[model samples]
Target: MKKVALVSLISIFIAITVLSGCSSNNTSENTSKVENTATNDASTNQTKTNDTAVTNETTTEQGVPEKYDPPIEMTTVGVNYPTVKFSEGESRTDNVWTRAYLDKFGIKLNYKWVVDDTQLEQKTNLMLSTGEIPDFMNVTDIQFKQLYDAGLIEDLTDVYEKYASESVKRMMTAGGPIAMDSAKFNGRLMGIPYTMSNKEVADVIFIRQDWMDKLGLPAPKSMQDVLAISEAFTTKDPDGNGKADTFGLAADKGMTMLNGFINGYHAYRDLWIKDSTGNLVYSDIQPEMRAALQALQGMYKSKQLDQEFSVKEFAKVSESLAASKVGILYYPPYGGSYPLQSVRDNNPSSDWTAYPLPSIDSTPAAPQVGASTNGYWVVKKGYEHPEAILKIMDFWIKTFYENKSREVMEKYVTTPDGNTPWLLSAIFSYEGFFNVDVQQDIKAVIEGSKKFDDINPIAQDTYTKVMNFVERKDEKFWGFDEVYGLHGARAITKEVYLANNLFTENQFYSTATQTMGVKMATLQKMRDVAFTKIITGAPIEEFDQFVESWNKSGGEQITKEVNDWYKSK
Candidate 1:
C-alpha cells in the first residue's frame, strides 16, 4: 500500500509543475502586450501636444476672447495719440470687427494702462522707475534703450526665430538692412522696427485756387512770385474786405506750427538728425540753418508773416486756413483732413485739391520727409508664451498684410490661390491708392488657375504698398517713386517755388539723431525770442546777438556733437 501511494504522489508533482509552466508563459505574453500598448499611448500624447501648437484655434464669449489660456495671461501697457477712445456707442476695449475676429481665434488685449499723448512718456517712465514692469512696452528708440538697460526688456533674437512667423521676421524694419541694423542692440534684436517706407509726397503746399483766380496771379512759380502774391493779398484787398486782415501767409511761427516749410527748406527744428556712414548727426548746426533762420527773420520783419505769429497755436493755423484768412500752407492730409472736411461741410463751393510738395528745382532737395515708421507692437520679455504675440503678429501679417510664409494657413487656402478676392476690404480701403488688390491672387493660386508669378504688376505694387510701410496721410500721394515720377513733377516744382520764396533747402536730416535734438531746442528758443522781439519792432540786429548767444550756449556743443556724429557715421 505504501509503494502505491508514493507512485501516485510523484505523478501529481509532475502534473503540478507542467501546469505552472503554462501559466507563466501566458503571463509573459500579457506583459509584452501591455508594454506595447503604453508605448503607443505615449507616442500619441506627444503628437497631440505638437498638434495643439499647430492646430489649436477657438472662439470665446464676450463677443471676443477676453482671456486666452493654454492657460496664461500677460499684462501690457499702451498709449494712443488724441486718445483712441471710441465715440458714443463704441466700446473702449474692442471694436465690432476686432471682437468678432478675437472670438473666432481666442485672444485678448489686457491693457495695464492706456495713456493719452500728453501723459504717455510720463506714465511710461514712472512705471519703469517703480520696478512695476508690465509684460511689454512700445516706446521710441531712446525710451526703448532706457528700458533695455534697466533690465525691463528681453533679447528677442531666439524668441523671434522660434516663434515669429516667417513673414513677421521679414517686417522687422523698412529701408532694407540698414534700418533693421539700427534697431538691433548688442548683436541681438532688442526691438522690432516700425516698418514704413519713405512716402515721396507727404506735405504739399496748398494754395486757394479761388484766391489765385480772384487775384489774377498766375499760380506762383517761385519764392519771388509767392512774395508778390502775398504782398498783393495783404495790401491790394483781394478779398475786398476793406480791412488789413489778409496777410501774405498766415503761419503760426510757434515752434511746431508752420514747420513744414522748415522741412521743405530742410530746416526742421532740433530733431533734424541725419545718418552718414553709420552715425547720427544734427542738422541745426549746419551753416545752411543760419540762412534758414535769417530768412524767417526777414519774413517776420517785412510783416509778411501772420500778424500773430508768436502767440498762435498750431490748431489756430488750421482755423485760419478754413476761415479763409490763410491762402497757403504746408500740411499733411491727416493734419488738414478735419479742417478740409469742415470747409466742405460749410461750403461745397470750396474746391480743395491735395497734391504732393513740388520738388525744389526738380531735385530731391525739394521734398520734406516726416516719420518713416509709426507705431509698432512689441512682445514682453517673459510672457508665458512670447510666441503668442509672434503668432498674433503672424496672423496680422497674413490676414491684414497678406503674408503667406507661415504654417497657420496650411488649411485655409490649400494652394496658392491667386484669384481669391480679399474679404477685408474695409481695412484695406480698396478705393484708395494705398489699397492692395489681393483677392484675385488668392483665388487664382488656390484654384490652380494662376501661379503667383502671373499676378499683375498692379497687384504686386498694391502688395508692396501694404507690407512695406505704415498708413500714410493721403491716398493720392503714393511713395517716393511716384513723388519723383512724371505725375509728381508739376506739383514738385510748385512746392519748390513756394518753399524757395519762403526759405531754401538748408540741410538733409534723418529723423533719429541725438545732437540735432539739443541744437533744435536752443535754436527754437532763440527763434521764439528773436521773432517776438523783431515783430514787436525789437532791434533787428538783436538777431546777430541771439545767434552769437546761441553758438556760445549749447549751440557750439550741438554743432560739434553733430559733426562728430556725422564723421563717425
Candidate 2:
C-alpha cells in the first residue's frame, strides 16, 4: 500500500506537470521543441511574422541541436518584493509568466529562499555564514564582495560575453553596465547583475491638502514657505483638536530628508567633496554638513519632528503618516501612497497631494539615483546544462518581444483605450521594448498629462501623484519606478514618469549590490545612533564628535572601502 501511495504521488505530479505544460526532462536538446509547442498552444494572437522575428533573432530555430533533454535548474534568491510574490500555497508553479517561458526551454527554477521585505539582509547573512550557499543568490554589494573574496561565487566574464543572448548583451551596452564591473574581481564577472532604471528625480514633500485649505494656505513654493506651512499645521492646530500634539514633519530621524527638499541645495550627509578647480566634490566631510546639522538641531529643539521616531522601523513610517497626524512628509509621490491610500479608503473626502522637495540655494541638486539592483536568474557552476539556462533567458527575450503567449498578453496589454486582456503581458505596450518610451511618456506627462480633460479619476489620481514628484530632479528618492509600475496600476503619473527618467544610463558602482556584509553590520549601528541624536537635537556641537565617532567606528573605513572599490572599477 505504501509503495502504491508513492507511485500514486509520482503519477499525480506527472499529470500536473503535463497539464501545466512544464517539462522537467533529462536532456537539453528537448528544450527547443518543448518551448515551441508550448508557445504555439499558449497564444494565437501573435502574428507569425513577429514570432519568426523572435525565432530568427533569438537563434531559437537552430541554436542547440535536437533530441537532448536539458538537465539543470537555475537557483535564484532575492527579497520578496510585492511584485515577485512567492507564497508556497498561493504562487502558481507554471502560472508565472517567466517560468512558463522557461518550461519551453527545459530549464527549472529552484528558489533558494524567500525573505520578508524588511528582513532580507539578515536572512541572507545567516545563509552565507552557514555555508549552506545555494547555487545562486541575489545579494547586495557588501555580500557580493564578501562571497567573491571567500571564493564562493564563480566568475561569469567569459560566459556572459560569449554565451549571453543578444538581448542581454544589448542591455549591457545601454550605460550603467559599468556597474557590472563592480562585481568583477581579479578581472572576472563574479555574479550576474540585477538592473534598474537610471533616470533621475528627487523626492517630493507630500502634505494633507485638506489641512492646507482649512488653514487658507496655498501650496508651499520655497523652503521658508514650507517651514511656515509646517509651523502653521503643527502649532495652529489645523485638525481642530486644540491640542499641541501635532508633529510638523514626519521624518524617521536617521534617514536623510534632503531628497524631499531638493528644490535648491545640493546637500551631502556623507562624504561630499569640492575640487580645487571649483567643482563640488562628493561631500561627506564638508563644512556644509555643519550648517545642515545646525538646521536639524533647530528642528529638534523646536520639537517639530516626531519625538517617538527613533524607535520606528522602516516600514512603520507609513503608519504615522497615514494617521493624519503628520502634517508634512518627504518622499516620492507613490511614497505617499500608504498614508494617502489609507486616507482615501477610510475617508474619501481626505485631500492630500505632493509637492517638490525644498531648495536651499535655489538650484536642483543631483538627486540620489539608487544603483541598479534587481531580480536576476543565474545558473549553478558545473550544471550539466548551463546552456539550458542561456536558452531559457533567450526564450524570455523572444516571449516578451513576440508577445506570443495569450496568457501573458491578456494580463499585461492595456490598449490605448485602456482595455486589458485577462492575462498579464511582461512587456507593456506603452512601455515598449527598450523601456525608453515609457521613460519619455513619464516625462511628457509630468510636463502635463492632466491637461487632458477626459482623464479617468484613477488616471487623474495617478497623474497628481506622479506630477507631485516630477518637479524635482534629485534621483535618490525616485528609485522604485519599475517595481511600482509593474506592481502598481497601469495609470501613469508625474512621479512614475520622473521615476522612469531616474532609471536612465549612468555607471555608478551600486553600493547596494556589493557584498560588504561586515561593513553594513557595523554601519547600521552607527547610523542609528548618529541619525537619532542629530535629528533629536542632542546637541549641535556633538555632531562633529558624532562624525568623529562614526569614522572611528567603521563609517570612514566603509567610505574609503567604497571609494577604493569605485576607483578600482
| Best candidate according to lDDT | 2
In model 1, the number of clashes is 33
- Poorly placed runs, candidate 2 (over 4 Å): 1-103, 106-143, 146-155, 162-166, 169-175, 197-202, 214-218, 240-245, 253-259, 262-265, 268-285, 313-320, 374-388, 394-406, 409-524, 553-560
Q: Deviation in angstroms for 258 in model 1?
A: 2.9
| Tens-digit lDDT track of model 1 for 287-351 | 44455556556666666677576776656665666666666666533223334444444544443
What's each prediction's TM-score? 0.59, 0.62
Cα lDDT of model 2 by residue, 1-569, tens digit = 11111111122111111111122121111001010001112222233332333445554424453213653455655333333333255342233544544434444556666555556667777877876676654565666766666766666776676677766655444434554665566677766654433322234566777889999998776677787887787788877888887777766534544334422344444332434653333344345555665665666567776667666643455566556677776643234333345544454445566655555565533344433433233334454544544554454544443343333332322222223211221211101112223333343444565242233222222333343334443222122231122222112223443444432122335444233445656555664576567667666667677667766766566656555655565
lDDT value, residue 140 of candidate 1: 58
Q: Which RMSD values do the candidates have, in order?
A: 24.9, 12.3
For candidate 1, the 10 contiguous residues with the lowest summed lDDT are: 33-42
The regions of model 1 sitting more than 4 angstroms off are: 1-73, 78-123, 161-182, 194-201, 242-244, 273-281, 343-349, 353-355, 358-364, 372-384, 397-523, 531-544, 559-569
> What is the alpha-carbon lDDT for the whole of candidate 2?
0.46
